[model samples]
Target: MPKSRKRKATVPAAPPPPRRPRPRMEYRARSDEAWYGARVVVQDGWLRVMFENSTEDADEWYNPGADFASLGDVEALRARFRRECPPLDHARCGDVRPGDKLCLACDIHGDVEELKYYDAVLETVERAAHGVEQCACRFTVRWTEGPRSGCLDKVGIEVVCCVPKSPIQDPVLSEFLDDLTKRFAEDQGTATAASQQADPTPMSEEELCGVLLSLKRAPNSSTGKP
Candidate 1:
């Protein structure tokens, strides 16, 4: 009888390690500065908040859902900046730029801004703020009727949140941009390789003539006739 070969013991491959969870972001507020969380407007129309003073009242109004007709025209809105707003370190940054919208929970002092002057490079990256006219993000509000609903009626609230430029920069967004750039490079490389493989290399003139001659009958070797 022939000897039988024994099979070697096989080890299973180990599974890949699990992915780590993404880091959570925490927005910081300056010692003197505080963010009034989203304030909701219950019934339609604006209600002037009654506080110790106009500055305190406007600060309360802008909290996460407070209603405002534009961020101004109210006495408290104008005075609050001078009264409630703390003096900043001017050495840190210049004036605000356009297109920058504020974040609710992030700090206003930690933000780093990207500035552009010339038109050529301006169109490449997105700008956060501009001049004194920064971007404002609006919150949708529906008017409701309370016991006093008949007093004012339906009016939408326009919320002006802080632009991150004056505060904290987002780390998650920076990472996403980096990932997008790498993906674009890989996709372009794949397309270039595919194009190269689709077209075959050309044959030499000598090769083409030899191939044609082989297919033709041997020039009448025995007969020596045309």
Candidate 2:
């Protein structure tokens, strides 16, 4: 018999390495800006929240303590933001609708809370545009699952000044803006008069002093306290 050709042993391909599970956190919540809003991030045995601001530069990040009291506080915290921050004018000025899922800017009316990391002004406003009833506008935040975190103490933070999201009037700021506009107009008028009919000399020291004193003494009728 002719030499039989030796059959070559076939080598099996090496088994692929096992895939590692991805470490990821899903953040979902109501926000005024794209990322600057109340959000909850769920991760390995932990739930993290940042509601003070919706931006990367938020005043604080609330790591809801790993307990019942902290978990219970979520609802109340959302309620407070809804009560204080003005809702974005989605119907008229913004892209959001009643059901559309997207973040809208908030109308922060007053100072932020120093200790609680919430808005200082808790009272809601009654918008005249709607007439009679208080503004239905509010910041809404919702999330699933219980909370867990390794943090020990609540964070104390100060947030940046909030710009209005729409034309909604803020009781504290509306009058102030009106006065600001008036002051600007007056200043422009003075400059125009000086350029057109008077000498180009800068304001004298005495005139500056008089203006400062007048501003200091000017009675503000807007705040009833004054």
Candidate 3:
């Protein structure tokens, strides 16, 4: 009769080490003097965003559904742009250098500024409505209405509602820019007319500052995009 050997106690192997979380790809704004967000554009029929960095080298096209871990790595991002995006003709980018306090490319058509403002407002709303139920985000931009031709006229914005998602059109942002551009055109026209009659009185620095302050206080509608 074979004696049964004592069964050894089975030991469970330790579970594999938990995976390290992937770093979130968040690029900060260029500078306090500049817009509080990145400059985005639709170039060559592709959505692209000019990183808010102190260099033109970070400009690259973006995929709405693609992963952006590369954004955290500048060199890697540039390489990706070189491989994927259109050539840097400077025709669309203009002379916008990080050296100046202004972004020439963004300011060329004035759409970038509006987009930047929209981005800032969105951030504010998020911060204020954090952890609160029934909080809604509303960002709007004009579609198919701007100079410089092409699809640049059609504006789109990156919107965040409940969960994070890709860019979408927001009527608020759209109306804001639309009204702004319309007023600008009217102001320019008036300025021209006044100039022909007499030296147009430019708004004083204080008055200009006031106007700008009001813009910064753009009303936030208590609604979310559907």
The top-ranked prediction according to lDDT is 2
Query: lDDT of each model, Cα atoms only?
Result: 0.29, 0.32, 0.32
What is the C-alpha lDDT profile of model 3 across 178-222, one tens digit per residue?
444465567679879988779767899999999999876777566
In model 1, the worst 10-residue window by lDDT is 114-123
Q: Is candidate 2 or candidate 3 better by TM-score?
A: 2
Question: Could you arrange the candidates by TM-score from highest to lowest?
Answer: 1, 2, 3
Better of 1 and 3 by lDDT: 3
TM-score of each: 0.22, 0.21, 0.18
The regions of model 3 sitting more than 4 angstroms off are 1-168, 199-226
Q: 29-50, model 2: which lDDT tens digit per residue?
A: 3332122223334444344444
Better of 1 and 3 by TM-score: 1
- CA-only RMSD, every prediction: 27.5, 28.0, 29.7
Local accuracy of candidate 1 as per-residue lDDT tens digits, 128-214: 343343332222222121122113221111122223223223343333333444555676799789988997678899999999888
Clashes of each: 20, 5, 6
| lDDT ranking from best candidate downward | 2, 3, 1
